[model samples]
Target: MAVYQLDDELWFPDPHLGEEDGLVAVGGDLSVNRLLLAYSNGFFPWFSFRHWKEPHWYCPLDRYVIFPKEIHISHSMRQLMRQNKYIVTFNQCFEGVIRGCSSVDDRNQEYGAWLGSDMIKAYTELHRLGYAASVEVWEPQDMSSGKRSAKLVGGLYGVAVRNAFFGESMFSLVPNASKLALIYLAKTLDGMGGLFIDCQFETPHLKSMGGKHISYDKYMGILNGEKDVELG
Candidate 1:
């Protein structure tokens, strides 16, 4: 299947026409309007810093997502949560979370990539406009002060459109920090009634947290069935 080449126009090809590797289109700027349109249509950009010639957009045949209410918390994670091992806050440090995610070193892993400077700049702008958001995990600074100050340890960032959340990346400086961030996000979304978290691609970690692979058609049904939702 030939990948569609996007021109100067702000448009994307039908996601169902994507190649086996999920490549739907190539060559497009990461403007806020473009990104928002892509997410609403169940498409997302995924390219490496080494291949910066043109941006590649994809919509996988097997879409992975997690219903907020269905998020699985392991016994260990529950214990840590009960102990208040980490404090989770939303939209606190958008840049810090993304920078942490981009800096994470997974050299020994098969699937590892960094968010290049261009991606960072684009997403930061999105956050400024309120489409993108972040969740921070922190540890207490000093108990002796009797005042609450936090030391950032881990977090995750994503773009929320309507009733869906597209998770971009997450990182942890200490064990279970990122997990806590995810748990908090899930619980909060669950409280908002029906919401979904787009995992994008399959990973063992995500699968363990109850992420499931669904057909693209089914995924679109959920995306299209919703009205524009406020992220706050």
Candidate 2:
């Protein structure tokens, strides 16, 4: 399929026309309305400033996602939860969590970051408008005055539609910290009657945590079916 080039005006191509690698369109501004529109149609922007050279949009033929009911919690993660080793909170530090996700040293890749300043500004605005949200996992710090405080260790941020969470990125400072945050996010969303957590694309790490790939048609069916779920 041909890649559509978007103007400063707000619009997107039909998500079903995406290519194999999921490059559906390019060159659109990251306005909050545009972001919301894209996510509502099962599309998302994912580009590296260095590698891709442009802000590319994608809606893969197959999507990676975790249904709330299918969330997997390992024995070790359960132990962590049982021990209360981490504290999880929502929207407590959205900016900090995004910055941490952008700045963390990713041992997997040697170069660029997808969460550029433009992306950050756009999503920060989304949070301000209550469309985007964040989850933070913190570890306690010993205070000199004998009071206990928690410092940020791991977290994640995503966009929330009516009944679906479009996960953008996540970061971890301690082992399994991000995982703990994920567990909390999934379970909480489940408890609240959310549909699924869209992972966008696939990765081995996400797969290990129970993310599964489904055809875009099926995904859109689920999205539309859950659009009126009234998760709030």
Candidate 3:
């Protein structure tokens, strides 16, 4: 249980230890310099401060992601896209997107998000520093009958790690906010030579977008490729 890491990069714990081993070290300030190094080297903060002693770093065994070429927009969703009922914007409502994501009502038996106040604050700080980003899809302003609700509803927040954009979390207030955002991100990745979305976990919704599972070893290769890409 060694602790007291750094504000920048450090060796990750061996996956064999699992989440319980809590090994090696933790506790690093999330500076843009630090976060960039972490993502470049296949590490990311879980956005925690439970123990002031260390910042936990994890390299899960499985990575979830989707290839832009394989995106699946259902016929109904395609129709909706055609309607252009909602508009997508980048980095407009960062805190709102994060709050929406952090507070999404988990109707599908999904409960208890690990994105706590500390995590929110940490990532929010990242947004302030411009190291992190959020993509927002706004509900049509006129759509609100009483107009509280609109077609604009979902978006996500993620970190750009070199060519690999590590997805942190996302929420959908409207019907397809998350999916629409992912679609745009996929297009961006295709242009950036992005290899994968380091989705730490799996979800059926992501799978519907063609998210595939790959070993962490392979994921590391994508990050450490010979052609180094400069991310925006």
Candidate 4:
């Protein structure tokens, strides 16, 4: 399959026509409208930020997702939850979460770093407009005044469209911090009748937490309010 080159026009080629690697197009600006359109149609921008001059959009045919109701809570995670060692909040500090995600492991200096300055700026604008959201995990810290304050430790951020969450990136300052955030997100979404979380790709971490593969057609059906499709 040929990789399409996007122009100044506000449109995308058919997602099904993407290359086997899932790259559909390249050279588009990450404007709010463009980003929203891409996500609404099951596409997302992910490329080596330092190497690529513009956004590279992808839409994989084999969709890996996590249904909120099916999110796995392992025995260890359950024990940690019972301990109540971390505090979780939604949209409390999106900037902190995004920055943490970008800087962890000095990703900016590494090749194939998708989260860069430009992407950060774009997503920050998305958060300002209520299109994006964050999940923050904090650890309690005692100040000199004997007052307790929470320090940002770990979290995740993503785009929310209707009933679906398009996960962007996540970071963990401590072991299982990111996992805790994901569990909380799943519970909250489950309560609100959320459909699924688009994991974008499969990872052992996500797979252990109940992420599963589904066809793009099924994914689109769920996104389009057709909830009767069977999940794999």
Which candidate should be chosen as best, given lDDT against the real structure? 4
Q: Write the per-residue lDDT of candidate 1 for residues 127-180, one digit (tens) a residue.
A: 999999899999888878788788899999999997788999899999988888
TM-score of each: 0.91, 0.92, 0.76, 0.95
For residues 33-132, write the lDDT of model 2, one tens digit per residue.
8899899988899767778777888888888999887888988888889998778999999999999888877722543777789889999999999999
**TM-score of structure candidate 4:** 0.95
Q: Could you tell me which residue pairs clash in candidate 1?
A: 162-229
**Model 3 backbone overlap count:** 9
Global Cα lDDT for candidate 2 = 0.86
What local lDDT does model 2 show for residue 126?
98
Backbone clash pairs in model 4 (N, Cα, C under 3 Å; residues 3+ apart or in different chains), count: 0
Tell me the deviation in Å of residue 148 in model 3.
15
**Tens-digit lDDT string for candidate 4 (91-188):** 99999999999887755566467788888999999999999999999998878888889999999999998778999989998999999999999999
Model 2 CA lDDT for position 52 = 74
Model-by-model lDDT, in order? 0.85, 0.86, 0.68, 0.91
Ranking by TM-score: 4, 2, 1, 3
lDDT (C-alpha) at residue 85 in model 2:
78
Candidate that would win on TM-score = 4
Q: Tell me the TM-score of model 1.
A: 0.91
**Model 4, residue pairs in steric clash:** none
